[model samples]
Target: MPTTIKEKTVLKFEPVHLSDLTKITDLYFSQTGIEKENTNFEQPKLTEEFGFPIYKLVEGNLIIGYSYFTVNSSEEIVFKAIIKPEYSFGDLESRFINQSKQKYLSKKELDRKGMKNSIMRMVDWLNWSR
Candidate 1:
């Protein structure tokens, strides 16, 4: 258990299975009472509607956050993240965007229209990922 929700805890991210939704929801509502009050929140039929991998952020064995993403044929990615209300982990959001950008760049077939800069950008991302 976290000692302080105000401080950001280093979290490890890994791909989550569809069957893990119940566990994720349990962790989320455990931190808040408002969710149980409404009963309006519905589980997104993500995999069936948009095919893509979802990643979960964990502190040891507990899943504290998850990112839902979808990439189109044009390489444009749509992303959304759900985190426990008590915790504020900004790095998770940046990583999700970084993954989206990296995916877009990987599929992008940029011609000589600024090839030098494009290569530089890719190199930078590679170094950052390390």
Candidate 2:
């Protein structure tokens, strides 16, 4: 289990599995209005190439959002929180920043005075599981 946001949501950060391709594609298409060719067929390959981890944000039994990251040296994280259009962006950004700060602290503690690459490597290993 990865870190949770707001003590109510459970964050599952892992590689994209065969079982979740459909749901991931559906959520992406629903949110972005752009359907990829062979979403179910090509997504796995794309995910592998890009080193992306599918993060499912769940509250209780309901999934609230999805976030993904590209595991680069900088660990660039691209996230999209699925919510109603009426949701407040300000509050959402603040919460996201806070959660990210917590993750940063945890990483800092694990690095043991190493450089950022070590931390990035740790994140990559955590995502890739190898």
Top of the candidates by lDDT: 1
> CA lDDT of each candidate?
0.53, 0.43
TM-score of each: 0.44, 0.38
Off by over 4 Å in 1: 1-8, 27-53, 70-77, 100-130
RMSD of 2: 10.5
In angstroms, the error of model 1 at 61 is 1.2
Best model per TM-score: 1
Q: How would you encode candidate 1's per-residue C-alpha lDDT over 1-130 as one tens digit per residue?
A: 7686586567776777756656655554454342433456643221211223357777877777666544444544456566775555557577764664465457655343344333345334433432
Residue pairs of candidate 1 with colliding backbone atoms? none
Counted clashes in each candidate structure: 0, 0
| Model 2: worst 10 consecutive residues (lDDT sum) | 43-52
Which segments of model 2 are wrong by more than 4 Å? 1-18, 36-51, 71-90, 97-130
> Alpha carbon lDDT of residue 45, candidate 2?
21
